[model samples]
Structures are given as structure tokens and as C-alpha cells.
Target chain A: MQATESVIYNRAGQRVVSPEYLLFEAPRTKHFMTGSEAVKEAVRRASVDASVSYPITPQSEAAHLIGELWVEGYVGVYFRGESEFGVMSEIAGCAMAGARTITTTSGPGTLRAFENFPMWAGTRIPVQLVLMARGVNSPLSIQPDNLEVGFLLDTGCMIWYAENAQDLFDMILAGFVVAEQPDVHVPVITVVDGFFVSHTREAIMLPPDDIALPPYNPYRAPMPVIDAEVPPGRFLRDPFVMKSNYISYATHASWQWEVRSAIERSRPYAKRYLKGLIEEFGDPSAELVFVACGTAAAQAKEAVRLLEDEGIKARVVKLKTIRPFPVEELKGAVKNAKYIFVPEFNVVGWLEREVRRYLYGHSDAEVIGSPRVAGGMTMPAEVIVQEVLKLTGKEVKHVL
Target chain B: MMRKRVNIRMPALGGQGAVTAAHIIATAADYEGYYAVSNPFFGAEKRMAPAESYARIGLEPIFDRGEVVYPDVIMVFHPQVITMGKSYTMPFYSGIKRKGLIIINTEEDLLTDEDKERLESLDVKVLNFPATKLAIDIAGTELSTNMAMIGALFGAIGCVGLDAIEEGIKSRFLKKFVASGGTASLDSALERKFKKKLELIEKNLNTAKGAYDLAQRWAGEQGLEPFLPPPPKKVTV
Candidate 1:
């Protein structure tokens, strides 16, 4: 059977709808799917111009599905690259050449492709990297652990964390729009906890396949597109390593600062397109709060329900945007909290550090990095509840 | 009172189709208008290796993700998952809730006396049936074993109707579905054996029907109530 009977027409013939129209206004039908499948559905409607692929566990199926999209003519140009480094570079070239480019990688693959991220941002190429965060190798692991995201925190790419398949679908479609804005044009790395999302099947609402997001307009880029239209900018044309002058050092430093600024500028567009940079769940005035992202947020939301059952007031401030940290939205979300818990899949508790760093002067709540799971371990909500109980000096009522 | 939410865990050997079963059960539940979620164990699966998967169906949206540490039901698709200690969780019934159900696919009882005592204290019921035998007998292939397991699950639960199960099966096989690389290849192998795709689907459906009937009878004999409330009735204006 054809992979998608719904993909009836070439992308060229598809009617291009606005991102808002595609996301909010279009009629939707609920379908059961895994996170990887959700990626294919998103790419099908994304009006993507190019995609590069490399095989990595948890992300391989999603990458394969995108290649299927290419074969079916939804994606204009698609090919498999030699490695994650090669794949990342290929996508950067596609974006620099004025193609709306996308790609997928995980764990070691993400780390392998690390150099291109900052370069893509420095080049101001609006490529979308769907990073399926998995465990990095020391002793190798293929299971879901998001430690790699910590490594990419300073990569100058606008980072988004999707809690599950549905969030992934919406973020990818909106990711392109927000990342491609003239003022905010930079690489967008949408991270979902590998396997937890990449392999898990759940229900998500999808817009009809006949419509698609408006195609990328390379002419609108703040930087010149390297399509031989206008002569490529001098800085883009030459490698900065050739010049050993003080101006080159200043140029590199200022350009890195501008890349960071571009990420900050994405906040308004991201807040508007993604609906909010953070999502609040559970009691609005909850004193016990959790600041989390990706699957940790999922576990925390479940913990909220279990806490409710125990007559505990708890809430979750799920951070959707990680690089352009939702500082203001988070402050508002946790204003009433006396104790804030940050649950994370990585051992570093990078999210906890971010929450602590941002809320230093804003809130007096004691920030605790509790119930951290690493090395591909699964964090059940019960673990979170037990942690809360122990921290509160209450009797532990649940364990798993 | 019926459960508003039910979490089911299936620990089976790889290639046994527990992952596919989990997907179809969740799909069937979704078709019945209930919120459902499913996932496989995060591991590199190989044939005969312990491969676990989970499915949660509920009246409310299921926010819980990753492994189902505490399951309302446990379905053991192969006796090796019990006899050979081939399971991710110990005793093949770890973290099962009180008054839950376990359906095993062997005709012979595989649980140790200690296992029986623990389950009894928890008020859990164990249903031992030859699901693979049913698959071989009805579908003329052992590959339909997961189909029998799916039937037995819904049959004992008595929540999702057969129509929804058929729809789930149809969507899985007839329509373009993505689960895993191994699953897709196994599907092609089954189709080649059956000669036609429609015939393959029909035989698989019959296998599920046969097992469902057997499970229904067993549940009736044990005076088991439906574990979950029936899917909320369709609202028609």
C-alpha cells in the first residue's frame, strides 16, 4: 500500500495556507499515531523544500518516513548523507541555498553534528533540526535521555521541547514560521525525548492533507540567499580564519552575540506561533510547582493528577522553549509557588539550573532538582510523588 | 464501579507482535472514542528477547508517558516470559495493581505457587489460554498469535466492541500503518503466506473472533465484570 493515500498531489500544486490558518483555522481529524509518524504528517503539510537524512536509533524511522515523503513528492529534494556531520552540513547548504530545509538526529548523532548548529545560526540559515534527544555514549545506550540538549543549549539555535507527539506536530509546523522570520531567522532545533516520543504511539489531531503551510521565501531573509541572485555577502563568501587581525576577532564575537540576539528576537514570534513559550497545568495557585520540559513535563503532569488524588496542591510549568528560556512566562507561572521542583531525564538537571538561574531575584522559592533519571532510565510519575512527599517531610504513600 | 482508566502491559519475546498488539488495542480504544496511548520498551529488540509494550485507555486524556510501571492488566504473550525469566520486570507481574487481570497465552499454568499466592493477595485474576494454538488453528499461522492476545484482552475487559477491534485491524493492515521496521516485514511475510491481503485480514479477524469467544466464556465462568466502563456512547443530535 502507498504510505499515504492522502498525499495525492505534488507539493507544487498544493494550496499554501498561512501557518496560523494551518495550525488553528483548518478543520482537524483525530488520528492515532506515534511521534515518528507525526513527524511525517507534519513534514507532509510543511511545504518543505529539502530534507537530509542519516540513520540513528529512535530517530531512524522518522528519518525514513521523511525520505518516503520525498519519494512521494511532498518534500522537493531529499537524500541520505554519509553521517550526522555530513547531514547537518548538507541541510545548512540547502538552507543557505534558499531551501526550507529539515533533518533529524539523535544522541551521538546530535553531538556528531554539533559544529554545524552554531555555523547555521552564524550563517542565519533557517533550517529545522528535529533533535530526538537520546543518551550520549560512554557506555553506549539507545534509549531516551536528553543530555544532548544540554550540549546544544549554547549552540545559538532556537531550541523547542515538545512534551509529546501532538506538541511535536504543532511545533515543527510553527517552528519553520517562527525561525524563518526576517528578524529571527536562524536554525530551530525542536527536541523531543527520543523513544518516549519517537517510538510511542498516541492520538493527535491533524489538519487535512490537501492544504499546506506557505512555502519559504528566501528573498525575505535578512542575509543574502546563496542562489547566485545577489552576490553573496563578503563575510559569507570568505572564511574568517584567513584574517588574523583584531577586527576578525571582534567580528566573530559580535556575530556570535547577534546570533544570540536573533534567538531572543524569536521569543515574540515563538510566543505568538506556539501559543505560549510555556504551558501551565494543575491548580493555578499551587504552592508546589514543577518546572520541566519534554518527557519530564509529561511525568510531572501525571504527578499533578496523583498529587491531586492525595489532596496536594501541585502544578507544572512546562517549558516549551528552552534556548530562549521562557523567563517571564515561567515567573508568572510560578509566582505563587513556595517550592519549585525541576524533574529532568538528564543527570545534569540543565532545566533546573536554568530555572534556578532565571528565578534568582524574581522568586524566593527554593529550587530543588529532584527525581533525576539518567542513562536511559524511565521516570515514572510515582517517583516524582515520592520525592515530593519525602521533601515535604510527609509519609510516602506511593512507590514504583 | 468500573475503572475510568486501564493500563495494560504486555511482556513478550520480540517478533511475538506484542508491540503491534499494543498499537491495535490503543487504536481500537481510540475508535471507541476513548483516549488511548501505547509504547514499546526502549530497547534493542531481537527475536525471543524480552520485548515489553504498554497501552493505556481512559475516559480522560492520558498524560502519563514512558513505561507503565504500574499496570492494571498484564498480558504474557509467551510462557518464556514467565518460565525462562524472560521479562524486563521480575516475576512477569511486577507493579501490577490490586484486583487487576493477567492473561497468559499458554494452555498450561506457568506461575509458581509463590506467584499465585501474591496474585491472590492482590485480588488479581489469571487467565491461562492457548492463544498461539488458537492462532494456528483459526488463522492457519502462528504469526496471528498477537491477534488472539488482542482478542482475549478486549474479551475479558468487555469494554471495546468487536467492531472497533475490526476497525483497528483494518487500519493496521489494510491502510498504510507505521509501527516498526520488523513489524512491517512480518506483515509482508504474512501476506505472502495468505496469498491476498484481504484473505490475510479475514483469517486474522477470525482468529481474534475465536479467541474473543473463548475469553468471554472464561470471564463469564469467573463472574468477572467488565474492567473498564464501556466507551462513552456516541452522541447523535
Candidate 2:
């Protein structure tokens, strides 16, 4: 992909925004902050209009930190909704009202907010969602279960994962840019592991002061005006819209079709931002490439380093974007590689399923190692090392 | 002196502020130009439940977010964790690496004959301090024991500097002073525990100094190695 100049704009579609929407580069500061804290500050840097809060562990620190920022006058609007369902509904309403809204949730909460996922997409309202990955009450467990992620794969929203706090900050920043695009408006679910990324502390560079993306400017060209600019006696939607026997079915089906095509059309924009988000590490020509995102990729980097010492040449395909899945780039990166190893934190290997779909027929699916250790369990580099050694018919030795 | 990368595991009670100490240690490591990953293994248990927090400081980004199965240093914030067998996996020095460091919060020898024998077999270095007593005597409360332990850790590993830890403390506590103007929230109980916010943080720092001085003096007498950079690997090829 050819690199484009970092051109900033004030108006997207017919909507006019503040002049500051254009490029405003400022100095960034490096801070030792947890992934959750970094994300909270990212939300502040973005100048989000309003964000709902329904605190759960791992993700609670993020909500709490954002609340602190809000109290200190750094954030615009922060509130704890009645529940996850209420929080999603409130964000939906806020987004429709041209509010740059966001919210964070985990396993069970994601399920509770299920009814509103389609609502946000069907209406084409772009709201940033911070999903701290967790198991969804799988056998009454409260650890990192990631079926919440797989369950959302078919949902109309775009998805991205952060490998570390650095990626966490950049991904969310770009997530807003990609989601709020006039032609491809859709909510983006940004994921981080429950405890791994959410709770762990690391070095993060924050955006400089006076630098932020423009606020959400809804394009009201085709939709009804959300502002108070409608004519005093202008006729709105027909009272009995569904009773229009003929066009009702066509209108409903077309709306759903548009939601999907918008995501397809979003491929270019997603690819543009994702190019900056994705990092490919390890030997490109090796027999196996460990494909992972979020914390799993963090460990994969270390595991690849160790494997190199043992003469087992391998590489890592660190995936950042999953929804507008990086099919083309990922295919190219692993073309010479023989096997794909996907270490998932979720019980259901959603990431592996994605790998198989894009690399179908070309790559055998079974070599995609799905040695899952779920339920708040973290797969250490040693675990991956032992498994890889076992798969290569070598005597497995514990490196840790 | 520096080390390639080191894992320090601190096991304490849920309400003992070990997790915060772990974060400060990581922050200190960051200030010292190293990568650090600090995380707490918390379950559904409430206050007084055994909590294990870990910090891995290294040259590169530390990624394995798993239990420190082979910790180079283990600091026990509470003595009962060993006596009561409260640890989840690393029960005391069970997984200490060879020539590792073990710092306990008790002055009196609390380890069993079996524990001492195991330590001798592993050739691990041990540093003991009455951290709770030091906190009570200096800070007028036992809550600063974690700070005391932090001081002793500095004395032993010397991987990070004292000024870094001080800066880490300031960044963490100063925010609380500002946040106090807002609504009463998660830490209101602790806020109520301290009559004044200044007293709470000041005493904690003073307690950290007390432990640091004690460990520095005590470690010298034991002939322990000062904090130094790791020697390069000797290749046999």
C-alpha cells in the first residue's frame, strides 16, 4: 500500500467540524502506566463527549481511572450506567445524538449488551467499545474466557486487539478514526486480555496536549437530521412505516445489506490504520509462524526468541486488527511458512478459526496449534515452548 | 550493578497493599531504564485472603503473564503466609532459583528446619526484617510494611535506585491528594483511616527508609553481593 500524507480534514461528508480537526501534531510524554490507565488517558486525549461505565474486574480499573479523569475536569462526561445492558443502550442513544461515546466491558457484560450490538450497527452509529477479554461465566468462572470475542465475530462492528500498552494506546486512537469515517461508520470493539494487558503495567507514550481527533460529526445526508434544523412543519417518517406493505421488507433487508457492505467498503481504511498497528516479528522464511494478537502475541515474541536459540527457526505474525481482518497482509506474511500456531486465551479458538478461514486450502488447519489454557489462565512462554518442542518431535524441556 | 532480568514475587494478604508496592517496583524499574510487567493474581476472595503479586524487570518487554514459577527473588509481606500455607503455587521459597534472594518480614527465624535445609541446599541468600514492627514504630501503623519490604528489596537486589522508587511513590500518592476533592469512592475507608492525607504518605516514605537502612546494614554483615550487572554468559564453544 502506498503511503499517503498525514492529511487532516475538518468536514467529513456534509458535516462541518471545528478547524482543530485538521492535523495538529503535539509532543508526546512517556509514562509508566497500566494498559487500562493508558486507555483511560487515550479516551481523555480523544476528548470523548460521553462514556458509560459498568465496572467489572480487570476492566474496572479502566472505568475507575476514566471516572477520576472526568472528576478532574479532563473528561467531558462519565457515568456508571444501571448495568451493561443499560450502558450499551445509553451509548447507542449518545452516539445517535452526535456524541463521541465509549464504554468498556468483559465476558458476561458483553453477553448482556448483545441486544444493542445490532442496534448500534444497523443505525450506523460509531461508538468506541473497550472490551477487556474474559470468559463468559463458563462454568461459573470469573477468569479470562474469550468466547465473548468469537460471539461478536459475525456482529457488524469492526474488531482490533492490542499486543501491549503501546498498541493499546495507538489502536484505540486509530480505532476512532476508522470507526467515525463518514462512509463506513460502525462501532469498533477494541480488545485486551482480562488481566494480562488490562492489569499489567508498562511504558506508554501519551499523545501531546492540544492534539486530538475531531469530535463525532454525524453525516445526516441520507438519515433524518439529528440536530434541530428540520423545517418547522416538515413531514418526517410515515407514522405507519411498517404498514407500507410493499417497501417495508425491501427497506429492512436493504438496511442490513448496507451494514455489511459498509464494513466491506471499510477494508481500505481499516488496512490503512492497521498497517501501523500490526507488527511482524521473527524469521519470515521459517517453517512455523506463531499467529496471535493481544497478550498472546506478547508471549509469542519471547517464545520465538527462545526457539531461535534451540535452532528451531520460527516467526510470529502479530495481528492487531481482526474484524476487518488483515487477510491479505497475513496471507503474504505466512506464505513461505509451513504451519500457523494460534495460542488463544479463549476456550473456543476464535483466532485460529479466523486463520483457517483466510488461509483455507493453502494451509492445513490442524497445524494451527490451539493449545488453549483458559479460565483466567495465562499461557506462559515456557508452555508454548514445551508445546512447540513436543510438536516438533523433540524432547520437551521446561525453559522457565 | 545490573541484572539481565529478574522476577520478584511478593505474597501478602488481600488488604495489605502488596499489589501497589508491586506497581511501584515496576515503575522504579522503568525509571531505571528497564522493562517491567507487574500483575496481581486475585481471586474472588475478599480482604485477608492470600494475594500474590509479581513484577518481572528486564532489558526487553517482558511478556509471559504467568505465575513466576522460578522467581529470582521472593519477598514475604506477611509471616502467616508461610505458617498457614496460604500461597497458591509458590509456597515460600519452594521455587527459588539457585543463588536467589529471599527477604522475609520477620526478624525472628520463622522457617522450619526443613525450610532452612532446603534454602541451604539451594544456596539462596536470605534477608530478614521486622517490617511490621518497623512500620508500626516509624509510621505509627502496620500498613506501611509493604514499603518497608520495598526498602529491603532495594537493599538486596539494588537493581533500581532509591530516587526512582521515591518518584514512583510521588506519582501514585499525589494523584490521590487531588482525587480526594471528588466523591467518596473505593478507598474512602482508607482515607478515613488517615486523619490527614499528608501524614499517610509521609509516614509510608519514612517507613520505607527505615527498612532500607536496616536491610542495607544487615545485608553487609551477611556478606551478600551488592547490586551489580549480570556477568556475560561463558560460552564453551
Candidate 3:
């Protein structure tokens, strides 16, 4: 199919012909911080108006740190509530009131927060949530796991998985834009590895606030404003009006298709942003590129470094934007690589499976899965490196 | 720039205020204008399965936020934790820096000759202070071990003075103790403990002429720097 040109008219009322250009300058780099700190910084950079959060392990620090930012008057409204339900409800109310709202939580909290997900999606509220993957049900441990993301897969919200601290920082920043985009008003949940990325600290190049984020777009609720002088009209009671609104239902479904298309359309832009990051630092191209998100990605980078020192070509493509999954860019980046290691802090059942599916028809690269059970324990870098070597038919020297 | 970073891990079961002791040390350091961060490594372990809390103090920013795999100081609030030997002590001992200090809250005679030999071989400066005894003598209850440890930390670091320690204790523990219905008694106990430690230091000065003179003299004789102990060797089976 031939790509048709979308015409553009200049201010002089004359047609102007120009090919599409997707380009962005490199963002500045700063010192490292945790995923939670990154999320809080993103919220601050995005000028998020309101945030509500409840305490949950692994994810609690994000909420606490954001609350600290709120107390310091760096962010907007902050509410510390009794439960995750209350936090989600507050986010929904804030979003409906035309505020850029956010809330963070973990596995069970994400599950409880999921009740608000459908409503928020239905109302087309642009709320951002940082969901830390943790275990639920099995043996009951409070360590890093991805069971929560599995439960959230069916939800209409876009999911972004961060492989390490740096990706966590970038993904949170990107999520603000993706969630607030008018064409894609679905809430975005950026999941990071609990305990591993949530609590662990590593060197992260945080983009400067002024350098990275675009202009803020405040949420607009569907409810129309009423005036005293104007005669009151029935809002939801008329069948004809409901039928006309059913057109909105079609619009909503089409909006979902548009989101998918925009995601594909945004590929070149995403690539430009990533290239900008690389230009500021350097390209992280290794022989075997480990694709991961959150803290696991951080470990993968360290592992790659260790492997490279041991005469192995290993690099890590840490996914900073999970939702609006940068599938095309990832495929393009790793298509030439021999092996793509995807390590998730959560269970292997969902995201890894999805990644494998995404890569199935696109690349011939062998996507190896290293699924760490939820709440098990932090998977050391040495273990990840050894796994990569094993997958590449290299002798493993270390075992954890 | 490299700065001295010390992680103090307390060995006490739940409800023993071991975590509070670590917090007090961290808060005391902060009060002294040193950067400090404290976090508890709490798990499913209940009252007796050996709970540990970590406190990190540094002049520079701290990066590694995991469990204190290598600690400059390991402060044990319970003597039984040491008696348990390899099982309870190995995890703590494994992380001790080469020139680390290990302060055990017990009577001096609690360590066996073999235990002393083992620690000496590892080059660990083991100080067996009767913190519980000191607590009972001053506070009339062994539960004031956290306060006693704070006093000991003040004695060891010397950077944090009694005033800062008192303020830290007041800010962190006073309200909590009062809320738990032991307000007056806990305050009096804390004051008495502080007074006793002050009296000991005053007496030490009168006898020895300079503060920490005896400690310095002993450490100098052993070719060790004052307040800076020798690093412990990595334990091998």
C-alpha cells in the first residue's frame, strides 16, 4: 500500500509541501536515582496537579518520595489516604476535574486500583500510575515479582515495563506524554521491578526537566459546563441523544485503533528521542542486547559490562516506554543481534510471553526468558550475566 | 571523594528496640551534620528469629541501598546472638570491613578464649561492653539497651556529642514511649543513663587527664589508629 501525503496549509492560505520529519535533540544527563525517585521527578517535570497514594511495600517509597515532593511545594496536590482504593478514586476525581493526576502502588494495590482502571479508561481520563510488579498468593513474599502485570494485561491501559533504573526514569517521563496525548487518552501504567528497581540505586542519567518534557496538556473531562442564563437541557436522559452519543462509543473504539496507529506512527519520534539520549551519552550497542525494563534492565547493563570485559559482546536495550510498546523500534534495534534476553522481575507468564509474541514474526533472534518468581529475592547481576553467557553458548563461570 | 561510610547492624529480636537504636545512631549522625540514612531489613521473622536493622553514616552521598553487605561496624544488642556463633554471626561478620569494629552488648567475660582468638585472628576490634548491665544499673531495666548503645556510640564516634544524642532520643523515642504509657519512667531512665555515662567520662578525664587518652594509648601500642579499628579478614571455611 502506498503511503498518501497529508496536505498542510500555511498561514497565507497556500498549500505547503513537506515530507514528515521525526527528530528531537538529545536530553541532558544527571546523576543516578531509584525508579521511585525517577517517577517522582517525572511527575514534577510533567507538572502533575494531583497525586493520591497508599502505602505498599516496594512501591511505598515512590508514594512517600512523591509526597515529600508535594510537601516541598515542587508538585501539585498530594493526598495520603488509608487505602489504594481511595488513592485510585482520588486520581479518578482529580482527572475528571481537569487535573493531571497520578497514583502509585504495587501488586495487590494495582489489582485493587484496577477497579478504577476500566472507569478511568471509559471516561477517557489521562491518569498515570506507577505499578511496581510484586508477587501475590504464592507463599506470600514481599520481594520483586511481576504477578501484578499479568493481572493487568487485559486492562485497556497502556503498560510500560522498565528494565532498570535509567529506563525507569525515561519511561516515566515518556508515559506522561503518552498518557496525556489527546489521540491516546488511556491511562498508562509504568511497571518497574519491586525491591530490585524500586529500592535499589544505580547510576541513572536523568534528563533535565527543561530539556526532555513537552508542554503540559491538562485533562478535559467529558461533562459539559452549564451556564445560569442558558435553558437547562437533559444531559443523559434522551434516547436520541444517547443514540448520537453511541457515535461517541464508535469514536472511543476508533480512538483505541488510533492509539495503536499513533503508537506505530510515533516510532520514528521514539527512535529520535532514544537517539538523542545516545548522542548525549553513547549508543549502548553490544553483540547480545538484553531487552528488559525497570531494575532488571539495570542489572542487565551491569551484566553486559561484565560480559564485555570477559570478551563477550553484550548490550542492554532497556525499555523506558513499555506502554505504546516500542515494538517496532525494539525489533529494528535487535533484529541483527544473536540473542535477546528478557528478564522480568515479575513472573514469566505475561509480558515475556507478549514480548516473545511481538518478536516472533519480526525477527529471527532467539529471545531467552529469565523469569524470576515474585517475592523470591533480588536476582544478582552475576546471575544474569552467567545466564546470557549460557544462552550464547559461552562457559558460565558464576552461579547464584 | 572517598568518605568513611559506616553501616551499624543491631542484633535483637522484635520489640527489643534494636531498630530504634540504629535510627538513633543515624539521627545522631545527622544531628552532627553528617549525611546519614537508616532502613530496616525486616522480614517474616517474628519476635525470635533474629531481626536486623541497618544504619549507614557517611560524609558523602550513599549509592548502594541494598542490605549492608560490608559494614564498618556491627553492633550487637543481644549477647546470645554471638553465642549462636556461625549461624547468627556469620551473616554480620561476613560484611565487616577490614578495619571494622564489633561491639557486643554483654559482660566482658561472655567471650570464650577460642572466640577471642578467632576474632583477633580476623583482626576485628571486639569491644565487649556490659550494655545490659549498664542499662539495669542506670535505668533499672535492661530494656534501656538502646539508650546504652547510643551512649557507647557517642563514646566511640565522639563526633556526635551527648547533647545531640539526647536530642535524638527525645525527638524519636520520647513521644513513642509516652504514647505507650511509660512516659515519665522512660524519661527518668534515659536521664539517669545519660548522667551515669557523663559521670564515667568525667571520672575517666580526672584519672586519665585527657578524654580518650587510655583508648588512644592502647590503640597506639597496638599500632592502631584511635577510634579507627583494623579491618577484619574475610572469613573462610
Give the TM-scores of the predictions, in the order they appear. 0.95, 0.88, 0.63
Question: Which lDDT tens digits does candidate 3 get at residues A180-251?
Answer: 656666677777767556754333554444322433444232332122222335443111324453476666
Better of 1 and 3 by TM-score: 1
Model 2 regions more than 4 Å off: A1-25, A72-75, A220-222, A228-244, A248-253, A364-366, A397-399, B1-3, B176-195, B221-223, B226-237
DockQ-based class of model 2: acceptable
Reference contacts preserved by each model? 0.81, 0.61, 0.02
lDDT tens digits, residue span B1-237, model 1: 457889999999999999999999999989887888999999999999999999999988888878888899999999999889999898789899988999999989888899999999999999998999999999999999999999999889888889989988987886564335553466578667446778889998999999889899999999999877766753211
Best by lDDT: 1
Residue lDDT tens for model 1, A1-400: 1233454333557776768888998888888899999999999999999999999998999999998888678998999999999999999889988999999999999989888888888889899999999999998999889999998999889999999999999999999999999999989999999999998888898998878888898999988888888754453532377656667778888888888999999999999999999999999988999999999999999899988888898999999999899999998888888999999999898988889899999998989999899998888888899999999787766545
Best by DockQ: 1
- For candidate 3 chain A, the 10 contiguous residues with the lowest summed lDDT are A16-25
Runs with alpha carbons beyond 4 Å of true place in candidate 1: A1-11, A232-239, A244-246, A398-400, B177-195, B233-237
C-alpha lDDT values of all predictions = 0.89, 0.75, 0.60
Model 3 sits at a Cα RMSD from the real structure of 11.0
| Model 1: per-residue Cα lDDT at residue A378 | 86
Q: lDDT of candidate 1?
A: 0.89
Decoy 1 TM-score against native: 0.95
